[model samples]
Target: MRALVLDRPGSFRVAEVPDPVPEADQIVVQVECCGICGTDLHILAGEFPPTPYPITPGHEFAGIVAARGADVRPDLPVGARVAVDPSLYCGYCRRCRAGRDNLCENWAAIGDTVNGAFAEFVAVPAVNAYRLPDQFDGQLGAMVEPLACAVHGIRRLGLLGPVSAEPTVVIGAGTMGLLMLQLLLHAGAGPVAVVDRVRYRLEVARKLGAAQAVTDASALGDVRFAVAVDATGVPEAVETAIGLLDRGGRMLVFGVTPAEAAIRVSPFRVYNDEITITGSMAILRSFGEAVDLLSGGAVDPRPLLSEPLPLEGYGDAVDRIRAGQGIKWHIRPI
Candidate 1:
């Protein structure tokens, strides 16, 4: 089998590798499509500590079951179409016992702590694979992971409805930001505004449901927002979101900043204005919800994709994403 292996920081090679066989309670999946995420770039740049080297680096993947290991359930048959859950949590952990598996003390993400799906085949624990409906293709299935993250954010913020038509702001206009903007609109948010320095991304944001898209905050005028989402990992975006929130407004930080990145704000502002600052991490119970939402045709990610590239072009795909050249890029592993 051929794969794009990240042997070390800033180095990736496309080479032939041995195919994996599943262990007990595991399955071997023939990967069809995998979406390149920002975290993949983080790993490449050495932002996060490298997991085991020479690992196939991709988590947002969907494929068909090539084989099932011993003790596998007959219901989840071989040849079943599936999308990966990616998160691995020990059921015996304190967090898992409390029903917060996303906060498991021994949590390990599939593509990070273990080998991932950027290959012709991957071995995944049966618990981490969810059967997808026949109507869902690998291309659309690849989006389930990222969309689940957005769904988790929305739930964590406890975004109250009767979400006013008054201006709502979203900063970043990147992939997550664009998705959140669309979701908010679908949920009845009005006059939604998106801010970003990139003109092209702002244009894409507008098409995705942003009522107003601007390269500079000056264009937002004196209008205050009832809700704000900071989808850029940049600290500047967080600070700007804090300043833009109306009294009693809530702001959700949906982006993952660098470990060293810090944002300093006035405690008096948060206290006096009753502002709420919430941070969302990985998806919890929303993976299934995201899949259902996509399958139900409630949210369309097709317009969000700028291009799809084959596995051989993985490096170029990464470059395009790093350069802000596309909304999202899917890799065809087959």
Candidate 2:
């Protein structure tokens, strides 16, 4: 099989690799589509180390079952469409037993820790694959993971109030920000505002549902929001969102910053205003909920997709992402 291997930091190469074989309780999937996530870029740049050298990079993917291990249930026969739940955890762990698998102490991401779906075929534990509706295309199904994450974050904000018309602000206009914007408007937010440093992304945000989009933070002068969210994946953006919240307002930290990054805020103001600053990690148990949203057409994320390339184009794909060229990129393994 031809796979994109991260040979080392600052490099990726298309090379021949042996096809994966499923364990007794696992299944082999013929990967159809894979989404390039921000974590993949960080891994390639030597920022965060999840695995040793020479690993395939992909996690957000969907495909058909090509083969199954001997112990796998025969009821789930070959050719079943499925989406991969890339987070593998020990069910006996304290966090997993407490229903917080996303926060498990010994968590291993599929693409980072293990060889993931960046090739024609990849093996995964049967317990980690969720069977999807037959009509669900792999391209659209690949979005379930990220959409599920957005669902977890948006629901955490408790956006619904008796009024259903509170002013909400979303900082950042990337794929995550746009999805959050759509979810906010769907939940009946009032005059949602989107902020970003890039002009094109802000425009996409407006088309998705933002009432206002601005590249300048000064444009938000004196604006108070009932709910605020930071999706820039930057500590500075989180701080900005904290300052934009109204008294008793709720702020959701939906972004992930570097491990070394830190933001300092006033403890005095936090105590005085009754402000709620919450942090959201990966989707807790929202994968199915996200698939339901996309399946039902309540939120349309199709427009957020801008680029599609084959596995061999992984390097160019990352370049485009680094250059701030588009919202999201998809890789077709077929």
My TM-score estimates for the predictions, one after another, are 0.95, 0.95
- Residues 108-168, model 2: lDDT tens digits: 8778888888888999998778888866888788888888888888767765223478889
Q: List model 1 lDDT by residue over 1-334, tens digit each.
A: 9888888889998889888989989999899899998899887776667377767888899999999999898877888999998888888988899988888898888888788988989999898788898998888888899888888887776752445566789988777888788777766776899999888888788777788999877789898888889998889888988888888888898888888888888889889989989988887988898888788876778777755688889999988887888788988888
Q: Which residue pairs in candidate 2 have backbone atoms (N, alpha carbon, C) closer than 3 angstroms, thus clashing?
A: none
* Candidate 1 C-alpha error for residue 127, in Å: 2.1
Each prediction's whole-model lDDT (CA): 0.84, 0.84
Error of 2 at 331 (Å): 0.9
What 10-residue stretch in candidate 2 is worst by lDDT? 155-164
